[model samples]
Structures are given as structure tokens and as C-alpha cells.
Target: MPLPDLLVSAIALVRDRRVLMVTARGRDVHYMPGGKIDPGETAAQAAAREAFEEIALDLDPDDLVELFEVVTQAHGEPDGRLVRMRVFRAETDASPSASAEVGALHWVTTADLDRCPPAGAEVLRRLAASGTID
Candidate 1:
């Protein structure tokens, strides 16, 4: 039997034709600033909590707009494992800095997709195709 999918919630913060991405401590691949949805937490709530924890940016759960979802082979996982990521778009006026598990922050364009994990690359592709980011 196949392993169950890993579920995650992610937030997209686009600015000036670029979207925010982060590298977790000890990881080279970039991903959106979010993480696994905790028990008893809505996806939106998890996204917001992760934004604050990972990037030091507080986000209101009410302001998160469901952007897209991606299911792809899990990066750094055993073969046949998959990840299901729920992506959300949210606007914030405050600057984001690396925090918690984050090691570095980057504002990336679609051209940088190769530096991301499979699911994160897909998010960049869709965002660029929609003209939400360059």
C-alpha cells in the first residue's frame, strides 16, 4: 500500500513582482513560509501561525486567500511519498525577517523555481502564469 500524503499549509507574500521564499535551517531548497497544519487548527490558521513562526510576520487568518493546491513527490522523503500543499495568498505591510526554523529569506521570481522543492516550484509556475509574480 502507498504511504499517506503529507499535508502542509503555505502562504505566499508577493511584492514588486517577486514572491517571498525561505530556506529552513540546514536546508538548501527554498519553500514558502509555512508548515504542517497542527491538530485542531484550520489550514488558514496554520498558514498564519507558520508565517509568524518562520518569518516573524504576523498574518491574520481572515486575510488569507486560498490561491492553489499542489500535490507532488515529497522532497527529501522516501520514494513514493507525496506532499499535498495548500497555498494561500496574504498581504502584509511589514517586512519579514528570518526567524524560528528559517535560515534565510529570499524574494524570488519564477526564474528561481529550480532552487525550490517540487511543490514550491509548481506554486511559482502557477503564480507566474497568472502574472501574480514575475
Candidate 2:
């Protein structure tokens, strides 16, 4: 396997609750809101930009909350042929605004997340255990 570049992903939370879960058009898995960090862009900047482009929600780099970082593959990402994503976590009062590239946006509770996507569920559990969120 070519293997994907190392990536960092973030889970968006609001009022100590996770707010967004992203699913591509054909994907059954619901991942967090995040994307690749451009060579010149800082991880924080990339997080905000990706949120806007992927969901039409404008976010400030400062709004990015430091969630645990993880590495994942981009072989079948909805966008580019390949990429390395650096993810972050933040809270937003705004609802998810979809862009052309995105298929659906769902607001989920920490409890609900577990049933929707196993991978996301596991991450949330870890983050919760780490005191990142309640």
C-alpha cells in the first residue's frame, strides 16, 4: 500500500459537546471536521479554512481548540487523490453550512456519535477520558 501521509484531525465541539460529524457522499463513516495543512499554512489556519470550504462555516483560526492529533490515510478522501490532514477541535455557534464538496452535515451528541461511526466513537471516548470534553 502507498500509505497516507501523516494527518491531524479535529472534532468540533460546542459548549463541551461535539457539534459536527462529516460524511462524504458515498461514505458510511462519519469523520470529524478537518483537512490537510498546506505547506505554508499553519495547522490552525488550515483547520479554519477547511471548515469553511467543507461546510461553508467561516471560522477563526483562534476558534480552533486543541483536540488530540491522530494520523489517518487519504487514499479515498472525497477530495484530492491524496493528502495529509491535520485536524483540530472547536466550538461554533453557527450551524453547518454545506459546500459543493460535502454531502451531509449532522449535529450529534457525544452519546449518539458512538452508534453512528465506530472510529469516531472510539476517538470521542478517548478524548473524553483525557478530559478534552465531557
Candidate 3:
């Protein structure tokens, strides 16, 4: 069965090459600071909301970078479902700190991308190729 819901995520790039990432308090992997879009919210709205929740950064709805949607091949689901991710880019007022759902925070550059989660690696690739990300 396919996953019922899609994930909408946003990448807030800073200093050209570094982007914001969050690690949930108990989680081991670093991921972009966005999350699931609630039933009534648009993908862009959800991206901004999640960014604020996870990183304590205030993202104006207008500031996010509009990138292509990503249809990620099934990787983690035992049921073999693809993940539809809507990724965006934007510059932030400042680097966000871990808060609420987040337990750790880091600013990652292309050089350090290999250490990030697979999804993040994909994002970096798209960013570098399209010039929307650093």
C-alpha cells in the first residue's frame, strides 16, 4: 500500500552553502527543518510552520524558496511506498536553534552533506544543481 500522506519540507539556506537541519531529541539522524502538512494547510504554509516549530526560526510565508517537488523512491517503508516531498528554499533572519520537537541543530555545507541523512543528501544535490541552494 502506498503511504496515505505526503511530506512537505523546506530548506532554509544560509551563507550560500550552509542549510538548516534539525535532529529530534531522541532521533539520531539530521534532517531538513520541515514536516507533514496538516490537513488544512498548504505545503508552503506547513513548511514555514514546521520550520518555526523545529528550529525556532520565523519564516515569512513569502520568503521560502520554491523548488520542484521530489518524489522519493521507497526506501524505509516495509510496504514499499514512495514519498512525495515538496521542498523549498529561503534565507532566514538567523540560524535557528533547536526547540520544541528539535533536540539538536546544525548548519551543513556541501562538504559535510555526506554525513547527513539520505533525504538530505538528495536535497543537497538538487540545490547544487539548480543553483537554488548552496
Q: Highest TM-score: which candidate?
A: 1
RMSD of each: 0.9, 4.6, 2.3
> 1-134, model 1: which lDDT tens digit per residue?
89889889999999999999999899889998989989899999999999999999899999999998999999988898999999999898999999968899999998898899999999999999999999
Residue-level lDDT tens digits of model 2 in 31-61: 7666657688778887787888888778788
- Cα lDDT tens digits, model 3, 63-121, are 77677777665335545455567887766557577887788887776666766656676
- In model 3, which runs have C-alpha deviations exceeding 4 angstroms? 131-134
Which one wins by TM-score: 1 or 3? 1
Q: Judging by lDDT, tell me the better candidate of 2 and 3.
A: 3
When 1 and 2 are scored with lDDT, the better candidate is: 1
Which sequence of candidate numbers ranks them by lDDT, best first?
1, 3, 2
* lDDT score at residue 75, model 1, on the 0-100 scale: 90
- How many clashes in each structure? 0, 7, 1
lDDT of each: 0.93, 0.62, 0.71
lDDT of 1: 0.93
The best candidate in terms of lDDT: 1
Task: Return the number of clashes found in candidate 1.
Answer: 0
**Residue 6, model 3, lDDT:** 52
Model 1: worst 10 consecutive residues (lDDT sum): 92-101
